[model samples]
Each structure stands twice: as C-alpha cells, then as structure tokens.
Target: MKEIRALAFDVFGTVVDWRASIIREGESLGRRKGLSVNWAAFADAWRAGYQPSMERVRRGEIPWTNLDGLHRALLEELLEKFGIEGLDEAEKDHLNKVWHRLAPWPDVPEGLARLRERYVLATLSNGNVSLLVEMAKRASLPWDLILSAELVRRYKPDPEVYLMAPRLLDLEPQEVMMVAAHPDDLRAAAEVGLATALVRRPLEFGPGRSFRIPESGFDLVAGDFVELAQRLLGREATAGPRRRGAPRPPSPG
Candidate 1:
C-alpha cells in the first residue's frame, strides 16, 4: 500500500449514517402530517427496497438510471404501502430530496477536514454525482472531487466502478485506497489491486438495524474517519526522514 495516494470513500453508510438520518427526517415529516407512523420502520423498509430496485436496472428489467431516480420510484411505492397520502407533488419531490440532505456521522466532517489537509479526497459512491454534490454542500463535506458510479454507470461491488476511480485520477489501482464501511466494497477493490481501508460505523444502520462488517482482507482498519486520518499520517510520517515542515506527497491527480 506504499504507493497508495488518493483515498476514495464510499459515501452512504461509510461517510454519512443514512439509515438513522432518514429515520429522523421521516419522523419529523410524519409528525407534521399527523400520521403516527413508525418512522424507523418506514425508513428501513424504504431502504430495504434499495437493492432489489437497483437489481432491476442491472438485470435490464428496466432502463438505466441514477440512484436518485431509483430512490424516487421506491419512495413512491413505500408511501402508498405505508398509507402515507395527501402529499402534493412538490412535497413528494422535497421528500425525495431528503436523501441529499442526510447529515454526516458525527465524526465525519471534522475527520475528513483533517484528512483533506494532506490528501486528495474524492467520493467514490454509488450515489449519483448530482446527489453526492448536493449532499456535500448540504452537509459541508470537504470533498476535493465527486466521483460517482453515476459517471461510470455501474454500482459498488462491480470492478468497473472500483477501477474507474484510478483511471479518472490518472493513477494505478494500487495508488488509490478504497475507504468504505462495507467489506464487500473493499473486497471488490482489492480484487482489482486497489489498497483497502475499513472505517467501522457499527451504528450506521441505527441501533437495531442489522448490518455488520465482516473482518476481511483490508490493508487498514479504523474506528472512524478521524482515526483514518491519524493512521494515514502515522504511515506517511514513518515512511522515511523528511525535511522539517516539508509538504507530504500527494496522490495522482
């Protein structure tokens, strides 16, 4: 992993806690509608539709589309299933945008800010570029570039998406570190010669939400983004003697 330079992160559960933030947003919106809905259940069920929804497109059962497009379709189905009605098109549109408004995991911004000082940080998310860009602005995420599956038209766990980043950044796969909360994503990255870093977010799915990160062939493991930055610095700092206060090396592009 010595040649690793750019650190590309998976955005949803990895950088921001999507499930919990969605629940909070749903609860607030439900309260306004006086709908006494189980917001947590609503959030989970909506997200549960996520994978099957994408597979439809991947299998060519439907047309190719961005995550936001896919999400809006699932959101409409869920609204009807949950008996959530009486919303105007405008309100529904706003609700669809909720994914764009998700707050970061508590440590994310501060940690990324610190890490950005030394590395060229880019988002390598399944989320669409526009969606990721909006989320970055909404949450004040300090991403140097937004590199999404939308650009590659492929999703996580696909070698295309994993390999696209290094090409876009003009580097070898080994010079790019794939940072994700999901072991499956990093596993895909590793299969293609990329370095891997796992940053745990045990509560990413919320307290009772059932997602787990299996131990895997990761190059590094971190408690959170802050720890990730600290460990990277430690690795670089120990690489060799350097002129005092000299700049650290940068990743390609």
Candidate 2:
C-alpha cells in the first residue's frame, strides 16, 4: 500500500453524478422549449448510447472519436427518438456540453482534497480531455492532472488504457490505485496489476435500479468517496484484508 503513489479515478458516475446532472440540464432545456419529456429517461437514454458508441471505436468499426463527439451524435439521435424538437444548432450544442458541467458527488471535493494531500490524483475516464478539464473547473474538482481515454486514444476495460496511466506517471502499475464506483472498472484495472478500490453509488442509475456492491476481490470497498479517502489515508479501518478471488454478485441492497 505504501508503494501506491497515485490514484486514477473513473470520473463519470464515480466522481460526478452524471445521471442527475444530465437530467437537471435536460429538464431545464425541456422547460424552455415547452416540451414535456421524461428528463430522467432522457438522461438514461443519452447515457445508454455511451457504451455502444464507444464499442464501435473499441471494435475498430469506426475511427477514434472523443467522448464529446460521440455524446453529440448520441444526443441528436436521442432527441429525435424522444420526439424532442425546436432545439437549434446552437441550443443543441449548448445542451451537448451538459457533460462539461456535471456536479461532483457531495463527498468528492472534500475527499479528493484529503487524498490529494497524500498522492497525485487524476481522472482516468473515457470522457475526452477537454470535457474533463471543463468539468473540473465547473465543479471545483481538484485534480492534479487530466488523464483520459482521449489522451491514449483508447477507452477503458482496454489493457492499454489501464496501462497508460502508470506509464504517464513513470510508476509501476501496482503503484497506482484505480478508484471507481463500478466493479467492472476495478476488475479490469486489477487484472493489469493496478490496485482496485470500489466506491459504491447505489443510486448511480436512478432510485429504483439495482446496483450490487462487490462481495470480495477488490483491495478496498467504501460507501462513498469520503470513506474511500479515510480508508486510503488510514484514518478509518475497514473490515480487514479481503481474499483475492472471483467477485461474488452482491445481494439486493
């Protein structure tokens, strides 16, 4: 654990509440346009296109496209599908940048402030670099640097993306811990020798969606980022060491 010199974070749902941010912005747009829509569903629908859009790039079906571009394309499709209209090019463009203004989870700024005192902190998200930079500024997030899929031209769950962070920091993979709300992200990082920490966000999808907490295999699991900071900084104690093995599906929350 002492060898860990840096923490690479998964930003979207891990740090910022993308669902809430997008829904808020979407609802604002709907009100202005006098269009009634399920803003939550719209937010979900926009996010739904995220993975599949990235998959195209991952599979070589399309050339490299940053998250910003992919998000715009997805938003356009969602608007048409949701039957939303009257948004002009400028309005569409402004709405597309909603991702840039995502608010961090309540614990993020304080937690990251504490964590930054101990180690270098940076974003390890699929979001493009510019988007992340804007988000950090808008949300007052304190990141030492911005490292994203755009920097390496590869999305996460890819070994190359996980490997890129350590290389950029001039450290071994084990010297950097990947902090995220998603187990799949942590598992992928762990597979490549980076330490893994899970920060559970039960309502990440929405109020009713089921999100299982990891039963084992991760290096640390905490209820939120502040707890994560406490565990990482040795301020609070966790249950104990976890046995490394396959992750058990979490029971219903």
Best by lDDT: 2
For residues 173-209, what per-residue lDDT tens digits would candidate 1 score against the true structure?
8878999988888888899889999999888767765
- Backbone clashes, each candidate: 0, 0
Q: Which window of 10 residues has the lowest lDDT sum in candidate 2? A: 235-244
Q: Pick the candidate with the highest TM-score.
A: 1
Q: Give model 1's clash tally.
A: 0
TM-score of each: 0.92, 0.91
Q: Model 1 off-target regions past 4 Å?
A: 208-212, 241-253
Write down the lDDT of every candidate, Cα atoms only: 0.85, 0.87
